[model samples]
Target: MSRKENAASLVQDYAEVFICPVCGDTVEVVELKSVVCPKRHTFDFAKQGYINISTRSMKVNYDKELFAARENIIMKHKLYDPLHTRLLEVIKVEAANNPRSLLLDAGAGEGSHLAKILDQMKTVTGIGIDISKEGIRLAASKSEKAMWLVGDLANIPVKDQSLHTIINILSPANYQEFKRVLIENGLMIKVVPGANYLIELRDTILEEQKRFFTNEETISLFKQHYSDVQIEELTYTKELHQEELRDLIKMSPLSWNAEQESINEVRNREHFGITIDLAILIGKNR
Candidate 1:
């Protein structure tokens, strides 16, 4: 099937999962090209293979260049390979008895993580949602099997109690929305930055800035919402080449406010060992 056909197929296959962001009414697939609610609110699928279900215009800071840089770091350099592997392991265990599981990646920038996870799972259907149009465009290009939508995390366009697993990787969480979308006994896997995460880059950009990071508050928040919450810390150092280093800095928000001169200085470094410290929080609905 053509890319357009594939996208239409995805929309038709998962039509029941979506609801109109405006009216909060169930949306129906229209001619495999658009989705419409009873109130006549319509959303069209992009030719490139994705849909936009955002109720209002978003003014996000992320752009095509940032997502491209992130894609390079994630797909080409395999920067998050270890984390992906661990997530897959957890997914296998969680989905062992339950086939036909539905996984949602909230704030999925470029859809790399969800795309990678979907590749390994046999019976899992994936949906990736992000607020950035640029990120969703990149995500649509990366994976046709998974449905990609541009929508707000706070007001996720999916129906309530619809998802089996929700993955929030290094992204802000809307606990109320998450709970509303999750089914009974649904799993939520959240990845948060640990104290030493990307220490080299942080130190490079702001040497004098006190490097204090913590997930204590985040963990407490998760515990309040979930019944069986577990936190695991994963840390490792990877030697990055000059180009990878450049992409890392360009792709991260840490360099957003830094001067061009400072970025160039970091880019000129031949090699830098960077830490990938993250806390993975696994929780089940209460």
Candidate 2:
């Protein structure tokens, strides 16, 4: 049976072992009990079976046009294939040792990574949450098995210490929230842009755009929240056609900062290969 069916079958199984989104504890999952911990904090799951445990909701800007461009780019090609491959490899590594259970894709913009990763795993149910309504809508339509939520990362609305694995790819991360939501021995996977990720695009946008990206910084931050951090960088070049060129700019943050003249020049140029520097960091919750 599918994971959705499986998750439904175990509705009561979670009644006792719910992962508390606050304090990272294994809290009770009973209904109308007014969830409370020794610390005197309390939360309640909504009628929809989702609990809001996040500390606060963040202000996010998400427009249909921006998400539309992102959808166009992600659907057309393998822009994030290397990152996706690494995530599956890690998930498989974990599954080889035990049964795969719950998977969380935090900041899971539109669910491509979760869909791809779970497509390779067995008996894993996925929850994908992003603050962008547009993103969650895309994710909801991305697959049947993955439950999609329009939510924030700093305050994950989950049971504390309840998740098996969470993958954060090319997006914002809240290590504290992740640490809270992950079970002991749980895995957290994060991907960030390495320097030279879009050098051509960056250079076109400005002469000194290098100040914005730092893979080293990303690693440094992960070290604070997780133990045994591992970093990997994958590089490839894809010769671009006109349509791909358009795809490249539309989804790129660099494009948002580019001058109109440079944007016009990029549109006119014919061929270029981008160096995609991505870092994959995997660690256990401490």
- In terms of TM-score, the best-performing candidate is 1
- Give all TM-scores, in the order shown: 0.96, 0.79
Q: For candidate 2, give the lDDT.
A: 0.69
Query: What is model 1's C-alpha RMSD?
Result: 1.4
Residue-level lDDT tens digits of model 2 in 48-153: 3333444666566666666666766556666767667777878777656656477889987766778777776777778888876666666666655565555667
Runs in model 1 with CA error above 4 Å? none
- Cα-based lDDT at residue 43, candidate 1: 86
Ten-residue segment with the worst summed lDDT in candidate 2? 3-12
RMSD of 2: 4.8
In candidate 1, what are the lDDT values of residues 1-286, reduced to their tens digit? 7676688787788778888888889888888778899999998889888888877887998888888898999889999999999999988886786776789999999999899889888888888999998899889988876888888899888898988899999999999999999998899999999999998888777646545667889999999999888889999999999999989998898887666787788899999999999999999986
Q: What is the C-alpha lDDT of each candidate?
A: 0.88, 0.69
**How good is model 1 by TM-score?**
0.96
Report, for all candidates in order, the number of backbone clashes: 0, 6
